[model samples]
Target: MSSKVPLPAGTTLGKSFEYGIDVNLGTYDVPSWQPVRRISGFQPSPTPQTQDAQTYDDLGAPNSDVTGWSINHAFNAQVNRSITTGLYLPEIEAVLARTDPDAKGEYAVLDARWYHKPESGAANPKDAGRGFFTVATTRQNSGPNGEIEVLSITLTGKGPYDKITNPFAGWTVTAPSISSVSASSPGTNPAGTGKQVTITGLNLTGATAVTFKAIAASSFAVVSSTTIVAVLPSDVAGTVAVVVTTPAGVSAAVNYTRAA
Candidate 1:
């Protein structure tokens, strides 16, 4: 006898939109990754070049040998143009640059990485692929009345795609940095006992903890990805360290002075 089991309740499946492609805006040596936005119907097509491997002595069926393979990434996107500013999105601008007569070097070739972003938490390295690609863009000129214009963009691989770490690994929570901390009320000595201070730096979103002189802040609020407002706790005087912690990791300590 055999039996079958059904999937458990509340099981979540991956969505097509979870996958993303990021183009390198900077040089390959020092890459600045930015996601290609406003895209729909993304598809990756991999084709293999085959050779005849069948021999006359073969039994039932003929055999084929795979010599090489290549992949073409394609997607459709609505023309992202701002009506007020009359500016196209950065990713769209990059794609348009490729059509220029004088386009060369990096503008001609796009260094890109595509990966699946986890439903929640950090991105896994194994879910990413990186390579250089040539861009092909076709703009739709005519469609049904009142229909929005669309662009068909294809990224033809220059070489093989390589499995690599997710360039946008810490999409959820990147470790925060403290550039400078200033008390709300100036000339305040010993920044503790309900004293509010503004902490500024990069990646301050979703902060889990803020500590002053190794003592946890009484309370904290993440204003943005680059700012945090925290109430200091009681601590002994003389320059102390301030640090922020997030899901990804803890930030390097920045010195804060607390007068004795």
Candidate 2:
């Protein structure tokens, strides 16, 4: 009998802490999203409203048709107030603004999005939801002896929820790097044709371009977040610097020598 066991098709799994929420603080027209800090718990409840659809003449069990849906996003956070600056966390301030008695218009509601953090060096992160919501804040138990204050915040959905790409793509981006570069045909000199070179590094996904000795490569392709295959310019010779560019920023140059 074979000793090997079958493996699951999907290997990647996510942790609870890898998910997060962001609240928009700026105006509706020009929104700025900031991550909620000091959160201890987060729960999103989606409920469906149903109506009876079964006819008296027929079935054994009554049928219920989904008529509508609603969601409530709630979270518990540790109240963090700065004694020196006398300022609350931006996310906490957003909820406080909605609780004002005279609050009107945009101040009465908040726009928010929840997303799953992507793996490091992902070119495009996905799986996010966004919507407008009404806020409710409640103060939790206070310990007279010694305990930190906590707040429970609930956001009732106002309308439709939208599936979206990562709202804060820049948050995960890091500058690309180049650790080593090597030509595929190391002994063959470029007799008027470009040489194939492989680059290995981190955060190399979505590479816009590659440069050899300050001269652009003939062509290049990002094989993965950590590798790139490029064709060196035919005119380049001797030892030269190589660099990679991506959305986040440019990478530090690594020296490479062409075949003599």
Candidate 3:
């Protein structure tokens, strides 16, 4: 959905919507949109009915129509969003206030939490990391008249953020900090095309040269410290590694399979 705020000219968005969660206030919010899945079309306007509780027929009836209902009434458009908050949340209190204003005691509250552990069929954390940080908490009434509703919350740290996103707490990267690496050629195996590859593993910057061990003698070339790009030597095939060295330390050969 759009407001009177017109977007800047020529701004296009990709597929997928994003959401988020906030621990500060123990609330869930929609933070942003990330294209994780492919999409063809969208329903930009779905009648524009509100999600808040009302006195009328169940889900509040349309407040008239969005100017011209006959022209376009549905919100069906591909939105590339990073975060959007204030989503619909059917508050149990709202229902109690409207339906049972005076009723007190012995009532249940419908607060929700971000369930990462099993039994809470939530999306995996790694997959979610690429997406937004959001969740919904709908305080549905404990009684019969309380129907299902939703309120989406997006997490936005109020304070300053680090220049570089540090790894999540209690997590570590396991990729080896190796010494050196090399790539072989698809000498015989037709499966692998002659793919040019860059070997990685050690402090390889300012390297004098990178070469194919058994493939070609002249297949060596100077490269940067962290990585070195090289072509597939003609003689070699299958997996092999390239050696790398610097003033600090020498790296072990990192294996790379050859492509035909």
Candidate 4:
């Protein structure tokens, strides 16, 4: 089924695969894996293939082995993740401290999800890429430049990864939150074109970017965890989604408008 939706004229489709989206992990009730720095290694197992041999028969027709045929087989799945230290995540800690742990065993079950919102258009704003997984190993690394020690967790799954519809049932995604955003000019400029804007939110520190409708701000300053100043990019007249991407993950998007 398909439906038509209205959009402002001259509104161009923005780029896809913009990085810095937040990734969360955990179970249905006591969801715990969160505040993750970044994640990767979400891929499917390679398909195993085999072919049958063919030969010419007395009737000059091709004949193939009756038992020889290609078939699909199940394989183990794997995922890699990197997260900050010091928070001491209880979920992962308990799994690591288990008396008996195995990558393929059911001792370390985990669930993961990543949120991506389109900068423009009537995007659902909650497209979550999710999967069921298990932790295989956890490694820690550090550098000499006073960098904080980061822990990397390797995950493996029994079969294929699947999506989760209701992830935030009990616990929330542990990351920065955006409360409000406004233009710094004297009057209300909905378009926000070429105007300095201030965004009020939580966990604005270590913010890597501030975007208007997914268009990155050329210049921005993080005054504090609750405030960020940025110059809005010129864009088509329409409602836009604004968000801040940090090392921890991307913040929930806030709505902004651009006047014609």
Indicate the residue-level lDDT of 175 in model 1: 57
- The models' CA-based lDDT, in order, is 0.75, 0.75, 0.32, 0.53
> In candidate 2, what are the lDDT values of residues 96-135, reduced to their tens digit?
8898998786668889888765454332356678888889
When summed lDDT is taken over every stretch of 10 residues in candidate 2, the lowest stretch is 117-126
Candidate 4: 10-residue stretch with minimal lDDT: 69-78
Model 3 C-alpha lDDT per residue in residues 1-260, reported as the tens digit of each score: 86678879755443233222111111123111111112122222212333434457646665442332111111111222234544222122222232243434422221211211122233244521211111222332346775433222222222222121211222121222344333333344332334456565545554433434424323334454445655565654566545443322234345555554
Ranking by TM-score: 1, 2, 4, 3
Cα TM-score of candidate 4: 0.37
Model 1 Cα shift for residue 92 (angstroms): 1.0
From the highest lDDT down, the ranking of the candidates is 1, 2, 4, 3
Candidate 3 residue spans exceeding 4 A from truth = 1-195, 214-224, 247-249
Highest-scoring model, TM-score:
1
TM-score for all models, in order of appearance: 0.59, 0.57, 0.24, 0.37
Superposition error at 192 for model 1 (Å):
39
Steric collisions counted per model: 0, 0, 50, 3
In terms of lDDT, model 3 sits at 0.32
Per-residue lDDT of 143 in model 1: 67
Over 4 Å off, model 4:
1-174
